[model samples]
Target: MRVHQLVVNFNATAQKLVNWKMIRFGFVLVVMFTLVCTVKSYTFQIPVEHDKNGEAYVTFDGTKHWLKDNKNLEYMDAQNCTVHLELFALPTEESNAYVSGWRLCPQEFDKIP
Candidate 1:
């Protein structure tokens, strides 16, 4: 009788552990799904012009010309004053989907001179 009671208790403990693990896994999956569903996408254009030194000057389509957040500027070479085109999209806000900003690099601009 004593041996039988021990076996039954052990089985009940194991079952509870398995149930808790399943609940934890289900919770993780639900959180991941929610995150995947809420992202936004956007596009912007950046205009570039050649300065007197032949370096690229970045310009935006609207009134903004300079970068709003320093964190958004990636792959920048301050010494060379150059950056990748996609850096312009770094400041964008993502809500329901992945939002992207448009950037016009120097190659896309026409020579003013």
Candidate 2:
């Protein structure tokens, strides 16, 4: 009878451990989903080209600026006619650079969409 009781207790403990692991996994999944959902998505329309020195260049409202190769543009925000620009790294195995963000010039504030 003691052996049977011991076996039952061990089984209960194992079941509890399994349940705890599953709950932890579920919590992780929920956290990940919340993070993914809360991230804002943005789209950029800047043109990227290479400069004479082989560095990447992006054109913002016709003004060209050199950028690091293999980066992506991240959009920050526009305030008082200044458009902010951010850069994100390339996610693929290619030789392309992208604008991570953009800041509109104060002069062109009326033309922004």
Candidate 3:
């Protein structure tokens, strides 16, 4: 009878100690962690440099590619081991402005073209 009463008292105290707000916050953190992991697994973004005479360059790991001429504007999707590239830049202010500096873009978005 004493053990049974102690068990009931412990359960009551445990229930009172739990805060609903803390549980809700923990749930949100789990969701956000999952979302970040899923996206990172499927997409890769690497910083790249641009050069004159129409060229873009990236030296990831220990590889160096002096990509020029026909392979000037190119992106190698490290996720799928595929290369998607653009041969020429558009002849407009907005389009030219975007590709003028070093940048990072998800390889999947550039994978289509």
- Per-residue lDDT of model 2, residues 1-113, tens digit only: 99999999999999999999999999999999976654332224454566566656667755665555444443433444445555433343235555656344454435546
> What residue runs in model 1 are displaced by over 4 Å at the alpha carbon?
40-71, 74-113
Better of 1 and 2 by TM-score: 2
For lDDT, candidate 1 versus 2, the one ahead is 2
How high is each candidate's TM-score?
0.39, 0.52, 0.32
Identify the leading candidate in terms of TM-score: 2
lDDT winner, 2 or 3: 2
User: What order do candidates take by TM-score, descending?
Assistant: 2, 1, 3
| Count of backbone clashes, every candidate in sequence | 14, 14, 0
Candidate 3, lDDT over the whole model = 0.52
lDDT of every model, 2 decimals: 0.48, 0.59, 0.52
lDDT of 3 at 95: 22
Stretches > 4 Å off in candidate 3: 1-18, 47-113
RMSD (CA, Å), candidate 2 to true, equals 8.5
What are the runs in model 2 whose C-alpha is more than 4 Å off? 40-47, 51-55, 60-63, 68-77, 80-95, 99-113
- Candidate 3 residue-wise lDDT, 8-38, digit = tens: 9999888866766679889999999988875
